[model samples]
Target: MAFSPLLDELVESLRCLPGVGQKTAQRMAFHLLERGRSGGTRLSQALSNAMDGVRRCDNCQNFADSEICGICVKPERRNGTLCVVESPSDLLAIEQAGDYRGGYFVLMGHLSPIDGIGPEEIGIERLLSRVKSEGVSELILATNPTVEGEATAHYIADRLADREILITRLAHGIPVGGELGYVDGFTLTHAFRGRKPLTD
Candidate 1:
């Protein structure tokens, strides 16, 4: 059965979301039209507002509705330590962990030469400028453990080698409850390299 032109257009638009294929999009469209029109209207309004109002935070490059994000304006968060992450989602994850209390720099992406992403493309110059101006005492490279993430971290560390800031990379290894036999060799190697001396 063929859908009306407007319904077909709605289904096609729904497919723009990640992981939403034709069938899923059609299901969603049908659900919205049949039983969730109010909810769909709210979603549409919210999406339109966000699309028009949201922009990158001036300080951290994270998504924000204002010039600087709320985190960047907090007085207690200016602790001279900056955590660098690959995206706003990573920042949110660290925030949810409830241990870190410092500023952040969202790279928005990792270096991918094949994809034409470089230091400049990922706002490295802005990050360097922020580091110099912010009097950052510690710079934590919290990028992911992937090859591109590692390369991005190394590149940033090398750029800041002459600075007095204490540069550190987040440790990667097996999970707290993970069995050694189930862990991959790369993770085991990292765990061994990052081993700490047992305290008495």
Candidate 2:
């Protein structure tokens, strides 16, 4: 027998998540109904609250509940060095790495002409203004190593070429434990392009 309208709607809604197919959504709907109705209700409320409360930070463009994110407000963070990333998730990853204590400016997205995303949409002007006004002297580009990422990095570099600020990109290569045989052609090319000389 077919599910009721509510159950069918639940399954269909669940399929909106990435990688969630019809069967998986149906299973999720059944699990939520049978074993975790209260948890499901709590999840729904939490989602609603988060959707309503979350806002992009004014300083760094990261997701936060307030005008600025915690990292941007922290006095301990390096202010003169700004790390530019493609998304808040990338900023989180860098934070998780526990090495970068500098400030961040999230592009939120790359410049994709075909996709209709442009420089203004990604807040490039805001970032440039911040660099000019906030005593920022360096920009570390932490964009992903992809075609769009490269284009975005290049665009920013060209724009800031006349400025006195220094600009650098994240190193792209195979992981520490990854072998050359397993590394792909694009990664190998990057590794070669960014090769460093060994200390004698």
Candidate 3:
């Protein structure tokens, strides 16, 4: 027997999620039908609410409901130290550490020239502007240790070469080609503490 259009649509929508295949989507649909009726309703509501209400902080690009995120607006975090990350997820990982008492600037993605993603797409210009306007004394590049992450860091460093701000990259303890989002909070904190300057 053929499935109804609504069921098919739910399955298709589930597949749009990361790592969800046809089988997984079908499983999810069945689970929703069984033990997840209320969950399904809540999921839909949460998705709609977040999509409509959540916006990027104009300065840091982190999720915000207003013009600036709470972290960016708080006066205590204004220590002239900024941590640059590849994405909001990476920023969250750093936040989980609770050791670094600085603000963040999320890149949202790394430089992928082959895929046509560049500085403009990642708002590098806006980042430069923030660095200059925010009176940032130190810039901690917390991008992942991956090739693309390194390339992105180098690109930013090159642009800010003449600036007096101290530029440093996350420590190599993160492992080569590893992502900041996947690293444990303790490890990330250690990495941040051990960060070194990005020399020529």
- Displacement of residue 41 (Cα, Å) in model 3 is 0.5
Model 2: weakest 10-residue lDDT segment is 1-10
Q: Per-residue lDDT tens digits of candidate 2, residues 24-140?
A: 998998899999999999999998999999999999899999998898889867569999999988998899989888899999999999999999999999999998898888899
Over 79-162, each residue of candidate 1 has an lDDT whose tens digit, in order, gives 999999999999999999999999999999999999999999899999999999989999999999889999999999999999
| Winner of 1 and 3 under lDDT | 1
Q: How good is model 2 by TM-score? A: 0.93
- Which regions in candidate 1 have their CA more than 4 angstroms from the true location? 1-3
Clash count per candidate: 0, 0, 0
lDDT of 3 by residue, 69-97 (tens): 99999988989999999989888888997
Model 2 lDDT, full chain set: 0.91
- Per-candidate Cα lDDT values, in order, are 0.95, 0.91, 0.91
Error of 2 at 180 (Å): 1.0
Lowest lDDT 10-residue stretch of candidate 3 = 169-178
* Per-model RMSD to reference: 1.4, 1.7, 6.4
* Predicted structure 3: clash tally: 0
Q: Report the error of model 2 at residue 35, Å.
A: 1.3
**Which regions of candidate 2 fall more than 4 Å away from where they truly are?**
1-3
